[model samples]
Target: MEYNTERTTLKIPEYGRNVQRMVDYCLTIEDAEHRNKVAQSIIDVIGNLNPAIRDAPDYSHKLWDHLFIMSDFKLDVDSPYPIPTAESFVGLPDEVPYPQKSRKFRHYGGVVKTMVKHAIEMEDGEEKEALIYGIAYAMKRNYLKFNKDTVSDSTILTDLDEMSEGKFKTEGIDLPHSKSFNIAPAERNTTAVRKKGNNNNSKKKKRRY
Candidate 1:
């Protein structure tokens, strides 16, 4: 799918260089099994890097975030389809760190909003599939999700397997996972009081007989 015209392109030359490095590294691996493993890792790395461009405090620039997300999405490995390149990096302002307090910030927000709009416009298939994979990978690795407990390699592998099968579902949006429904002490106390009130009323009615 074509990216929104308003979103700015990223200025990171190292991103392309890193992709090339990954491609080269993948080519060097001899065994097909090992190569596939490395390829998956590279894909995971790219996926992780994409969201960081937008979410990271350091790379708060909208153009940079949009470019990174698109470039990573366009990168094709082992596909017969042609992969998009840095030359495709278009629609960005020539200046860096766009005037922070200027009207341009509104334009940048519009660009991001448009990108999301286009994402929803995309039909269910390869484009949606790639996005799901990218998002799932990011969620798994993000510190917020696993702050107290570290996610195991086996768990990642299991999720990867589910992803391959197209059964890997996200909570709330795609699939609804069972969430804890704990009753607060105050709520429990309130229920107890209500029950006691009903019991007292019953006792009063019986005494009237």
Candidate 2:
């Protein structure tokens, strides 16, 4: 028995050695008409190997291309579609550019940075102060959530000051303590819902009589 190691390497291994041998036999056919007919038959055989390709728009075109590729582009047969050349292949895709804008603090997120920038441009008034306080409070909450540890109000103030480029001062304003935010309302709501469901199920167990 002839082993693959001893045999010449197939151009396209997916077509198999038998298909490759058929392709080799196809190249040796003297008559152009007979070669074309044999080539079409060979395409039908390979095309059946992958019935999924029939759904494609250029199904026959792809099959002819595969035929040329299997024959090492030496098969002189009439093709309906444009025959591909080595030079026709486009190289690797273009590189995508990295984002220019980046957040000052990733944990605090981009929204906080935007708020800080907006606050810096705002007029000195009551509305701006409220927005500033809200931003700071949100920052602390995000920091706690990400780190899963309690943070001091001063740390939040210092971070807010540094991130805003010392434009926003946290001197007079006092941030709310982390203790209040420990128990999230969402968790409480979920627990309440589960308890209510259990009560309903227990009630359902009692007869309508």
Candidate 3:
């Protein structure tokens, strides 16, 4: 009996062993025209074996690339797409550069820092003040949500000043109270209170009856 160890290794296992054998046979064909015809047929079989392969952008190009890969790039068949080199599959991709700007407070995130930078650039006016207030309020709300602790208004003000290079201030601004941090919790409390009130009324009505 032919065991898996005795057989040739599959180049792309997704296409299965039979497809790999077909690719191997394709490389042996002397005539380029006949080899191209067999290659196309093999690609059709590959598409049937894995329908989701068509989901890729430039799917026909990708399929042709796979055909070449399965044949170990030995098949001299006419291809619709640029024939990928062995190095294309083997070589490492270029390194992606990381952002140079560092976050002052990671909890508030990079977006908040960007907002603060923009706020600093804006001319001092009513619009700037409104923006500063909104930023501060948002920071405090976010801080409370993440930390699950009461973050003092002063902390949010301090972070804003540091992030904005001491440009923003909370001296005259009326920021939302700590209770504003969790609207859902406040809503839940209100619901519980109303439910208690209804239960109490029901008990009183039962006593009267």
Native RMSD of candidate 1 (Å): 19.1
Clashing residue pairs, backbone N/CA/C < 3 A, model 1: none
Ranking by TM-score: 3, 2, 1
Q: Candidate 2's residue-wise lDDT over 57-117, tens digit each? A: 8778777877887787789888888877655545421221221235347667554665577
Better of 1 and 2 by lDDT: 2
Worst 10 residues of 1 by lDDT: 174-183
Model 1, residue 117: C-alpha shift (Å): 6.1
- lDDT per residue for candidate 1 within 1-209, as digits (tens), equals 11223324433433333333444555666777655544554444443345534454543344333333434544334432334455665664233222122232121222222222333444566444544444433334331121334444345435444434544333333322212212233543554566578669987785321
Best by lDDT: 2
| lDDT of candidates 1 onward, in order | 0.40, 0.67, 0.64
TM-score of 1: 0.25
- Report RMSD (Å) for each prediction in the order shown: 19.1, 29.2, 25.4
How well does each candidate superpose onto the true structure, as a TM-score? 0.25, 0.41, 0.41
When 1 and 3 are scored with lDDT, the better candidate is: 3
